[model samples]
Target: MSKVILITGASRGFGKIWAEAFLKRGDRVVATGRNIEALQGLSDQFGDQVLPVQLDVNDRQACVEAVNRAKEHFGRIDVLINNAGYGLFGAVEETSEQEARSQMETNFFGVLWVTQAVLPIMRAQKAGHIIQVSSYLGLIAAPVLGIYNASKFAVEGLTETLALEVKAFGINVSLVEPNGYATDWSGESAFQAKPMEIYGPVKDAFQKAVSVPGFFGQPAATAEAIIKLVDAPHPPLRLLLGSFAYPSVRKVYEERLASFEEWKAVSEAAHGSN
Candidate 1:
């Protein structure tokens, strides 16, 4: 059976790759992006299997309308991929108020608004899947990407709670955390903060880390994992893409556990004589 999948940020990158993959397999997609013309190619190639919608996910009302349009056109929405977001690169001290808020608006609040709009429709159907495109930085942290990391961290928390809350309704929620991908996320789609000389060394170190060989994975390689996730009867709460995510995150957890154990006495003392 062909499923109705609604994907945001379909103009390019992972969203476009996954949308085409689904359409090639006969699934219907409600593909959305800020530029409708950029999405036209999907409709052109896939015919009626794709519905291109012009959307700016930061607008809460627009998010709601997009969901309504999908429900009306497809009769039901079987899957939603929240892939509309960009990276904000800068040090914490150098980040301006507007930059931080804008990052939160698109990366964090945008996901919230779209998810809220689709919840009622999915609840009525009694079966649906929500896939959030977060990053491995959501689980760990990276210098010069403080704001982007914060946004994904918020997504990780939100999706984890959503999974638990919607389990009884037969709704599945999964966080797709991809570690450094060779995409335009670091190029045209990215927002850069005004550089400060004090942080030059920090910025340089971050740049060198990313330039290392084999640090990034191919974006198209993720399509198979995403398809498998949506097709699973019982999908995972969190799915980490790319080879770097697993071992890297595992190390972070181990270090966290050790710290927790080291502070066990202090933590217990904080409870006082309750």
Candidate 2:
């Protein structure tokens, strides 16, 4: 059976890759992006299998309309991939108020709006899947990506709760956390803060970390995993893409566990018998 999948940020990056992957497999896709022109190729190639809609995920009303359009076009939405988000590269102190809010608007709130729009339809159908394209930074953190991390962290928490809440409705929620990919995410698609000399060392270290060989994985390699995830009867709540993600997240958790053990007495004392 061909499934109807709605994907945001289908103009480029993993979004476009996954959209084409689905279409090639005979799945219908409602491919959306801020620049519909960038998505025209998909429509040209896949014809009616792809619906390229112009959408700025930051707009709540537009998100609702997009969902409605998908339902009207395909009769039902079987999957939704919330891949419409950009990275904000800047240290905490270097980030401006507008930058932080804009990041949240598009990254966090955008996911929220689109998910909200589709929930009713999925609930009515009693089966659906929602995949949130988060980042490995959502599980951990980095120097210059503080705001970006926060946005993804918010999505992680939101999707986790959503999974639990919608389980009875047969709605599956998964967070796709990729460590680093050879995508335009960190290039033209990213927002950079005004550089400050005080944070030069921090920026340099961050750059060095990402510059290591094999740090970034190929974007196309993720299609198989995504297909398997969507086809699974019981999909995982969190799926980490790339070889770097699991080991990196494991190390972070181990460190966290050690710190928690170290602070066990303090943590217990703070409870005050409550």
TM-score for each model:
0.99, 0.99
State the lDDT at 91 in candidate 1: 95
Candidate 2's error at 148, in angstroms?
0.2
lDDT of each: 0.96, 0.95
Per-residue accuracy of model 1 over 1-274 as CA lDDT, tens digit each: 9999999999999999999999999999999999999998998899999999999999999999999999999899999999999999999999999999999999999999999999999999999999999999999999999999999999999999999999999899999999999999999999999989999999899899889899999999999999999999889989999999999999999999999999999999999995
Task: Give one clash count per candidate, in the order shown.
Answer: 0, 0
- lDDT (Cα, tens digit) per residue for candidate 2, span 1-274: 9999999999999999999999999999999999999999999999999989999999999999999999999999999999999999998999999999999999999999999999999999999999999999999998999999999999999999999899999899999999999999999999999989999999999899989999999999999999999999889989999999999999999999999999999999998984
Q: Which residue pairs clash within candidate 2?
A: none
Off by over 4 Å in 1: none
